[model samples]
Target chain A: MTAEDKILPKPLVSVRGLRKFYPAGRRFPWLRSKPPILALDGFDMDIFPGKIHALIGPNGAGKTTLLKILWNLIQPDEGLIESNHLADDDTVLVSGEERGFYYRLNGWANLVFFGRLSGNSRQETLSRATQLAERLRLSGILNRRYQTYSSGERQKLAILRALLQAPRLMMIDDLAKGLDPQATRELTDILLELARDGMSILLATHRLDLAAQMCDTITLIHRGKNIATGSPQKLSQQVFPHRHYRIVLSGDEVTARKILAGSITSDIEIKDGHLSAELVVSDEEELAKLSLTLAQNGISIIELSSLEEELETVYNHLLQDSDSNDG
Target chain B: MAAFFIRDLQIWVSYRLSLFLDIVGLVGTALAFFLLGLAFEGYIPPMLEQYGGYFPFVIIGIAFFGFQSNGLYGLSGSLREEQLQGTLEPMLSSRITPLSLSLATNTFSFLRTLVRAVLFLVLGALVFSVDLSSMNIPSAIVVLALSLPPFLALGMLSGAFTLAFKRGDPVRLVYGGLSVLLSGLYFPYQLLPQPLQWLAHAFPLTHALSGLRAALLNGASFSEVSTQIIWLLGMGVVLLPLGIVALKLGHRKARRDGSYAQY
Candidate 1:
């Protein structure tokens, strides 16, 4: 066997040639189409022992479907998913969706309900619920009904419920949504610690910053297909060239744009009476030279920063690629 | 299985106060009927005379029917309510088997129904001088046990339809109509017309009620009601698996068709 195969202490989970398609409707059942609405056309990805894989995509991009499939929330129409981690990896962790909790129940009750469902004994489930409440800083309001909790608190409770299972593979759907800056940072840190403790994490989120900070690898999905997969830095450097600098000048925007026309080889836009030009420069020295020239030209430099393209840019790029390829 | 059971317990505790109110309401209805029976004791003889002067038999039927009715309501009713609130998928995705989960979900209703049935039995007899003392209490218990599988199975079958077809009233109507006509709640099977007699015989609920009445009211021995017991057991054995398998398959079908969460 290969070294890679040997290192997979247990086969965490495997998805082979997964396919899912939804028929349009029963009224037009006889009306045929060339292809069904392929939610997950053909997906192949392995979540190994200790990696936080971020699944980033736009809305309707099939990230949620893939997570659902892996969680076995619903079976795939045409695929084989086998896991050596059945007793261990069987937990389907999800957050921020309305259905993942009982609204009438308090946070602790909901946790205990799920813990027992995950095969914990009553005593064990209760203890774990208490522990989770304390850890998530929800001890103060663990007795309050979930409906009365704020969106972020509910999301945290959902995460806590999932954590009570001590899941082998934690699948967080869109956790960063509705979280403030500090909470998001704390969550990222917790995820990182979970990863360090040998749990595989699959986070689906629109926020690229969280993914960059926490995830070891990233999977970019667009329109139900795996478009790109790589490490965060690799994907960033490959997809987003560090060759551009954004110069924000506060002045008569039209005149600033006219002045920067000499420096602009790419696109430029004027917003809120400010001229932000995307200029290509090799290094900081060239950028500094351009900054001085702009200063000399009476363009008050309100802000100057290195413009790094994010996963969103890559997402839109892949979308444009698909669109033009179809055209 | 124990874990699943306790899961049900925790779920009940979560809504314990609201469930107490519902229990009060159900038991209150039965109590009102008992009081009305007291005020019009003379008019209730037809009900007592036709069913062997044992008001508990009638009470048991009503209590069981109330539970079965609640199960039907809970299955279809919770489906609609949860579907509207978009909580269906999360509940369905839990680690517990859907059969076990359904039982757990209806846990409070089951206890409420059982409590109401027993209270009505005691209260109805006190008011109407109905005889519930029986020589064959074990046989009566056996009959109750035998009837549960098919009753729960039928409840699940209705629940499966509710899971798939949200707006269709046909499933509920079929179950309600059959239970009323055949379950021997209001009258004896012999009192029904010939065609309806056969229909009642075909129903497991009828056999259960008959078996309970024979043991409790007629002082029938265990051997005497064995045939009815076997019939109840047979329906349970057959329909329980059928109902569960049908629901699981239907669930998968809906999920594959991408309408698993459809309202």
Candidate 2:
């Protein structure tokens, strides 16, 4: 492990055996009992300080439920959530719901009100709010009523309000819900910068691509149960044992296909002067052996590229596996 | 609390047309009562003879009823509004305690009601020549002060209903309607039938209005108005804890249902 990894602080928040259930449908006199919807069933997570931990799942996967539980906005039916800063002013939740702010008040007034409630002095709140507004590129519209802001701008202001608290742990739900591409990129950059500056973030989102790209750790949840937790690369590796490689050959495709057929057990397809092959190699050594074998067969490799396993594919594969297991 | 107050004030000020219309409505109501008072000048009830006019008696009733309605309705309405706007969860997530939140939600409405009470009194004295020179102002203030807690407790109860059920807080409507009909806001409770008078006594507003009118119109001292004060205080003592407990339970139920943020 790198020195930087070794010195990382302990978890700012740890959740264990967390369970929450909501009653399904309306109660009727004739009905004996209403079934409960399992929102979070034995969900576990450890969010380290200074790390951006992404809680990623599909809709109805309980990402927002978990966030609300952590924020203390909702109580879990059964769980042990240990957060170092749970009751401290240093923890803040930025919900994706658009109605948090007072619509009649301007962005600055809303920020100031929330900031003071979170324990900042009046002067300090104003100063921090100004700084955050400017950082989020929201200074230009801070004076406008919150109802007048576009969805993206409103979201930016929400993020700014959370930032104004200068929280030690910031819980963000669906951080990119209504943002434009540019704003999403800007928010991603801001989160990364905050993480670098030692802010622990619990980001709940369904945007797997962004989670893979930006999060230090990704926790995949399905049906309110944690499926896997690791770095994006590690998760990808866990899901996909075999790696796919696409090779463009300068020589004849027939010869390249023939050369790969003997060495690789997986299927090989030749298309448009390229040979696609899957190799179940555990390490680079095995891959190198495969490459040497192809070279020895008098085939020159023109351009070889490994088709990296993507977060989307891994997520789908995990969910499908879980489904089949349940079946 | 200050932050909440400032935020509410800013929002209230932003709706200038609503603010203006509110004042206009209050003035219009006073004007209607003035005309009615003139017609009934010769028919003043014996109970209201000490006050010298139906206008003074009714005006005091209206002012105190204003306080009760604003406290109870405002609390629940504000909570429901927050839930509909999706801000309840966020506000609850803040460092403020539940009781503090309850009080903070009513801050604007209570202040606005106080302003309207003053305006009503001024209009009554100036336009209708309702006498206030003989009012035991200190005793009246004490009675008003003592009357606040019970109404606040009722407000909290209504807020709890809104928190749990999202809509259809029966207490708000029942209390509002009953206070108007039985509590003698428009007339004296003596006019109601025997059994209904007993029912009226159950409401804190009945005692509060009686105490306010006694202190303000009849120049009653602390001892004279002490019975009503004692009843209001007793209700507050019993209901305050009940209200807090109910609100806490309702909050927990909402959280368990995962419907705290749902309107």
Top-DockQ structure, candidate number: 2
TM-score of each: 0.79, 0.92
In model 1, what are the clashing residue pairs, if there are any? Answer: none
DockQ for every model comes to 0.36, 0.71
**What TM-scores does chain A show, candidate by candidate in order?**
0.73, 0.84
For each candidate, the alpha-carbon lDDT, in order, equals 0.71, 0.83
> Could you give candidate 2's per-residue lDDT for residues A106-223 as a string of tens digits?
9889888887877788899888888877777889998999999987787778889878767889988887887789878988988898899999998999888889899999998889
Give the least accurate 10-residue stretch of model 1 chain A, judged by summed lDDT.
Answer: A84-93
Once fitted onto the true fold, the runs of candidate 1 whose alpha carbons sit more than 4 angstroms away are: A1-16, A28-35, A46-49, A79-91, A236-242, A245-307, B1-28, B31-57, B70-94, B102-108, B166-171, B258-261
Which regions of candidate 2 fall more than 4 Å away from where they truly are? A1-9, A29-31, A84-87, A247-259, A263-282, A293-304, B41-44
Among these predicted structures, which one has the highest lDDT? 2
